[model samples]
Target: MESKELINKSAKKIWQKWSIAIRITPLIILLALLKILTHYLGWEVLELNALFTSLVAGTIFLIGFLISGVLSDYKESEKLPSEISASMKSLVDDTYTIYKTKNTLTALEFIEFQKMFCNSLINWFYKKEKTKVILKKISEMNHFFIELDKEGVQAGYIIKMKNEQNNLRKMILRIDTIRDTNFVDSAYTILEAMGFLIGCCLLIIKIEPFYASLFFTLVVTFLIAYMFLLIKDLDNPFDYSSNGESGTEVSLKPIHDLRKLLIDFI
Candidate 1:
């Protein structure tokens, strides 16, 4: 059951229905047209079937290695939203704890701060703004703790909440590192060239029954192109979708759960 759920999530993230097909369609069409031309013109120039097999095996091995590395990062990313959410919830809970005992922390202010920070962070995902803005908002939370300290709230409580805030900052920076950098960028270029060369090899190689060549050409071209695109998207696990959109982004359910806790607390 757990495996099935991960499969479902991964499938959605990798393909997202029409988007995958649309991106690969051009590559497919080019390969298909080349396949047909070779057939009609009877232009089987030095069959590459034996060499093609070796090339494919090598390409697959390389792609698998790169994908495993990317997948490790992605699997780690799947846990981050929950981590951030839990950390954020602790802050809210701390505020609640302080408010209940000392009656000094402002509930309204914390609620507003949570809402603003969440919205801003999502906007950053959407490429609408810079992360510095979000970082600044996080720093602003220190003011609340400062006020708490002044109110004679226990120093331990204030320090703990401050620590939680720092953890949140660390997680966000970790996210920034993943989201901003591509893994094995040089390898991507090599694989892209390899995929193209493999497609060319498929186009030229003649097999028993011209239809067999055509079938393999289309299928192989599509698979290679699709996997390349999927891996590219997988690199950006936090590629969150907006307003009922489906995408390859890792699930943000924990973040939403934290939001619910805040709303209910309010």
Candidate 2:
């Protein structure tokens, strides 16, 4: 799988839908309670207060979800543009390859063959765009095996291929940096804002005094910041972390599997 798809698939497997539902359910309940109170509360002496509570509470919940949805859409869109670029390049390559390989045939037969080949190329490009991009990219890598005999003074030859270790390392580092510098997946930030808004709403209803709400709000804010920091530390899965390194093992495992196949073929 391509790196983006692989990470997405892994995320799907790791993060179940039920878990997400559970996390959001509490927030939904809290918002619902605020809505009910604002609509039904006795307003003989506090008509303005009831109006203010409904307006502010509804605004906060709406803003939070809207922000979350926008961020999610942006993240998904960013990935597709890159994939489309890679696939377009591969389609051009395939078409050119077919056109260059001329063979003798009848005039009608040759025309039919040309159409068939072009159609096949188009289908191949469309159906396997992600795999084609990965394959095409790796195929162009300048790989070489430098064998070292007794003395390591360039004793043996360098068997060069398109795929090179340097290229793979560079690609891995780019992905590593993306994961490291991710300010997008700020789940804790969302949670913190939600907590503070909830606290403020409670203070409005006299459930807690404004001073107590302020203190609790600060505590929730700090906790959210700390949790995000923890997630950021883990986001760079390629880097060594408290749990261990992420991509290192998977990267080498593929090389070993390829070596095994080559040995069997030989």
Model 2: residues with Cα > 4 Å off, grouped in runs: 1-15, 26-144, 148-163, 184-191, 202-266
Per-model CA lDDT versus the true structure: 0.79, 0.38
Q: Compose the digit string of candidate 1's lDDT tens values, residues 51-146.
A: 778888888888788889899998988888888888888887877777777766464477578777876766776768787887888999988877
Q: TM-score per candidate, in order?
A: 0.87, 0.31
Colliding residue pairs in candidate 2: 141-162, 141-163, 142-162, 143-163
Compare the candidates by TM-score and give the number of the best one.
Answer: 1
Candidate 2 total steric clashes: 4
Quote the RMSD, in angstroms, for model 1: 4.7
